[model samples]
Target: IRDFPTLMTKARICDEDGKAKSSYYKAMNDKKGKGLDRGKPYENKGNGN
Candidate 1:
């Protein structure tokens, strides 16, 4: 599950403003295979030079 629930299960007690919780869910869905995240970062798609 990409270590999501591992954190969300504690979000209720960790995040007071719920900002971290929201971002976590967004990241889980937006992130693709190979651990590639293209949402907040638009530069990680390097050609591996």
Candidate 2:
């Protein structure tokens, strides 16, 4: 039962612009779960860092 809501929320996050939200990144950072490094997805690509 509890899993259903989490599943739905995750689906919604993925649906938004086909990218995970900042909250998703934060949660992943805290729990070491699913998501890229913090700020990785939003980093300045001009630096190539």
Query: Which candidate achieves the best lDDT against the true structure?
Result: 2
Clashes of 2: 0
Q: What is the TM-score of each predicted model, taking all chains together?
A: 0.30, 0.31
Q: What local lDDT score does residue 23 receive in model 2, on the 0 to 100 scale? A: 68
Ten contiguous residues minimizing lDDT sum, candidate 2: 33-42
How far off is residue 41 in model 1, in Å? 25
Name model 1 segments beyond 4 Å from true. Answer: 1-17, 32-49
1-49 per-residue lDDT for model 2 (tens digits):
3689989988887788465576687777888744464565556878876
In model 2, which runs have C-alpha deviations exceeding 4 angstroms?
A: 19-49
Clashing pairs in 2: none
**Poorest stretch of ten by lDDT in candidate 1:** 32-41
Q: Give the alpha-carbon lDDT of every model.
A: 0.68, 0.71
